[model samples]
Target: MLKIKNLHASIDDNGVLKSILKGINLEIKAGEVHAIMGPNGSGKSTLASVVAGKEEFEVTKGTVLFNDEDIEDLAAEERAHKGIFLSFQYPVEIPGVSVTNFMKTAINETRKAKGLEEMPAKEMLKLIREKSELLEIDRKFLSRSLNEGFSGGEKKRNEIFQMAMLEPKLAILDETDSGLDIDALRIVANGVNKLKSKDNAVLVITHYQRLLEYIVPDFVHVLLDGRIVKSGGKELAHELEEKGYDWIKEEVNA
Candidate 1:
């Protein structure tokens, strides 16, 4: 559902253009889950941001095509309106706004963008209950402030909860596994798996294979130095786990 071709991007650091993603080429078909593994400063998150149409980063070359249309000129919210969901690495906390209210506003905004009337209150409540239960979230949790005082797992799960509610066609999870304990990780991954289907795609950017153990991607891609250096089946994740990225770096430099 998403295709990226020779994508080069850079960020302005105090007015100097610092290149990050260089010549990134990838394609994610519908119903497939893809994992991107890379070391620090390897442009993993950059790739995610560029795809989500973040404003800070500029695309110097190439194109990001969603379904069949190029999305280079689309703003972040417009891209979101088009069913591109990006889960942030660090989700912001809104202390005064309750989770339920926040989600209600967000859903309504997206609907308004689509020229649709607001969803009925009854339907919204039903959806909230179903999605929270699907992720094993307590109703009490929903009444609390959004991401406020939430544990790492709670924050990640809340993002997944939003994902469930929005039902985006392409969900880009940027390091969703960060700071999660094993049990928390399982819950998050389980929620993700439950949401997967024949029409949606997930792009998981992570540093470890443990996340893959739970999500079980169809393809494992090793990204190094702003480019995807290797691609393989799920077993490649295990190999990276056992051997670390050193071997891949060695091979790349050889």
Candidate 2:
């Protein structure tokens, strides 16, 4: 459902152009889960931001096609309206806005974009209940302001909850496992796994292979130096876990 061809992205640091993603080529089909693993500063997060149409990073070349439509020029909100959802590494805190209220506004805005009326109050409540249960979130927690003073685990789980409600066709989870303990990681991964379907895809960008144990990926890719240097099956993640990124760097240099 998502295709990127020869994509190159750069960012400006005080007027100095610094390249991050140098000629990336990837294709993700529906129902597939792809994991991107790499060392720090390998442009993993940059790729996610570029795909989400973040304006800070400029695409020097290439195209990103979602369902055969070029979305390189589309704004970030436009991309979200087009079924793209990005879960941030650090979820921001919104002091006074309850989770339920935030989600209602988001869903209605998306519906308005599609020329649909607001969802009926009863239906919206039903959806909130169902998705919260799916993510194992407590009803009381939904009313406690979005991400405000939430623990790391709660923030990550709340991200999954938001993803569940949005039902985006493509979900890009950028370091969702960051700062999460083993139990929290398992819960979040379970939610992601349960949410997976034949009509949607997931792109997980992580530094460690441990998260893969819970949410098994169909493909594992090694990204290095602003480009994807290798692509392999799930066992590739195991190899990286055992050998570290040095071997991948050596192989790329070879």
Superposed model 2: Cα runs more than 4 Å off: none
User: Judged by lDDT against the true structure, how good is candidate 1?
Assistant: 0.94
RMSD of each: 0.8, 0.9
Q: For candidate 2, give the lDDT of residue 249.
A: 88
- In the range 91-191, model 2's lDDT, one tens digit per residue, is 99999999999999999999998899999999999999999998889999999999999998899999999999999999999999998999889889998
lDDT of 1 by residue, 137-171 (tens): 99999999999899888899899999999999999
Predictions in order: lDDT: 0.94, 0.94
Query: Residue 61 deviation, candidate 2, in Å?
Result: 0.5
